[model samples]
Target: MFDVVVVGAGPAGSMAAKTCAERGLKVLLIEKRQEIGTPVRCAEGISKKGLQRFVEIDRRWISAEVIGAKIYSPDGTEVTMAEEMAGNEVGFVLERKIFDRYLARLAAKAGAEVIVKTTFIGFERVGNALRVKLKRMGEDWEVETKLLIGADGVESRVGRIAGIIKTLKKSEIESCAQYLMSGLDIDENYTYFYLGNDLAPGGYAWIFPKGNGCANVGIGVLPSIAKANAKFYLDRFVEKLEIRGKIVELVSGAVPVYGEVATAVADNIMLAGDAAYHSDPITGGGIANALSAGYHAGIVASEAFEKKDFSANFLRRYDELWKADFGWKLRRNKRLQEFFLKLDDETLNSLARSIAGKNIREMSIEAIIAELIKKNPSIIELLKSFLSP
Candidate 1:
């Protein structure tokens, strides 16, 4: 019987397996895809500081190093913010295909057994272990595991089967559509953001450079308020861009824009990554949080094994670790997202104009919130905590 069984081979799963195996646990990591990281579905941008906190990012996995970003108003007014001003000195656009495989390799080297083209069908409790049903390359099999980690994506089958997470509303999920295209005349060092209700409805559009005149142009929309689906808005935005090359790849996915699940721990099961709704509500970014959660969950799970206890009470440590690290911050960001959803194009344009001449280095979140509150004091009650010192 494996000590831990991790579903999915994304960053979270690989990190969980690696961490557990390094602690002397027998870990099993599985992926449904024939090949890991095929057809990437992310914006692939990570803050330089955030990435450094976990791993020394290998140069092979970096597609571009960005120094700053530009936020555009509905009327084409631009508010340039340096990376330092945003508190992230630089950002790296990753080659996710290479990075995902590199992480999987790390897990394998740490003694975790890795399986590909394997799908987790269901699980049943058998005494103190779990009987995991899996389909491998058209064959069905089962494995016994003391603990299970759900590192699956937003639409997590494992989470549903384990009954750890509830069904999500469309409003709580951000639908995304993106295309990787080359021969673009964009500033390779600056990620561009476009904001307007007509542009992306409740969300926004982005252009993250991938070097070599290539970039990932994408749009996210809140289904609750979107006039059309994400693809329609993305197609409309793409038509207006001055892209010169053919679209090389199309990527589409949904991210849970909520905080962690109500209960990420259930007896011998735990959910991590998107399955636990760890993505940032304001930006739909989850890689950093996913890695952090997986690492902590592994630690907690290992300790549980050492104590010979796998009950929900013993696994509460995992929930505590993630909440202390990121759960609180994610909840605050969700409030910010709610405020953003209420903004109209005129208010967004006014905000851009208000910050046009400010030194980007001095532009902090608090300052921006203060400026916004000046224009709309009615929101003071909602933003008091975020703006407080």
Candidate 2:
């Protein structure tokens, strides 16, 4: 019997397996794809601050180093913000194919066994253990595990089979589509975010530079408000930009906009990364949170295995750890997302104009809320909910 079986070989699964194996636990990492990290679906942009805390980002994994950001209003008014003002490197557009493989190597080095082209089917509880079923090459095999970690992405079936709520409300998910294009003339060192209802309702469009005049241009909108297909909207925006470029790659996906899962841990199962809905509600960023949750879940699962207790009470440690790290911030961000959805294009443009000369990243949450309340007293009630203990 394996000490732990992690489903999915993404950042979260690899991190979980590595942590467990490093602590002397036998771990099994499974990947459904024959090869890892193919058909990359992410925007590949990550804030430099969070990456530093999770792993020592290898130099090769970085596709482009960003120094600042440009925010464009509805009517094309642009405001630039520097990394120094943001107190970080601003962001990094990663080469996910290499990065995901590197993380799997870390798990292997830590004494975890990895199986590719294996698809997890279901799980059966036997006495005090769980028997995980997987299909390899059209053949079925079962492995007994003391603990199970769900690191599967957005449409996680592992969490669902484990009896965790994986359903996302229409308003709580962002439908996104992106295109990688070459011959695009853009600032190679700065990421751009376009905000407005007409551009992307309840969300924003982004241009994250890759390298050599290449970039991942994408748009995200709340599924509830998206009247047409996400790809349709993305195409319209790209056309409007008058980008003279050749499309190199295309990616379509959904990002969970919910905070931490209500129950991240069950009897002998735990959910990490997107499986746990750890993406930021406002920005729809999950890479950092995924790694964080995976790390915490790994440690807690190891402790639980040693104690031979996999009950909800024993697994509560993972919940506590994640909450301590991200709970408050996510809740606050969710409130901001709600507020953003209600704003019209004119209001967003006016707000952008107001904050044009100001350093937005340096502004405190309370200060921003106070200004919003001053401008629109109707938002005062919602702001109080986020500010109040």
Separately for all candidates shown, the number of backbone clashes (residues 3 or more apart, or on different chains) is 0, 0
lDDT of 2 by residue, 39-135 (tens): 7879988878778887897989899988777888898877666645433566788999999999999999999999999999999999889999999
Model 2, residue 16: displacement in angstroms? 0.6
lDDT of 2: 0.84
How well does each candidate superpose onto the true structure, as a TM-score? 0.94, 0.94
Return the lDDT, model 2, position 349: 80
Best by lDDT: 1
TM-score of structure candidate 1 = 0.94
lDDT digits (tens) for residues 166-274 of candidate 1: 8789899999999999888888888888888998988889999999999999999999989898999999988876556679999998989986565689899888889
Give candidate 1's whole-model lDDT. 0.86
Error of 1 at 186 (Å): 1.3
The deviation in Å at residue 313 for candidate 2 is: 1.2
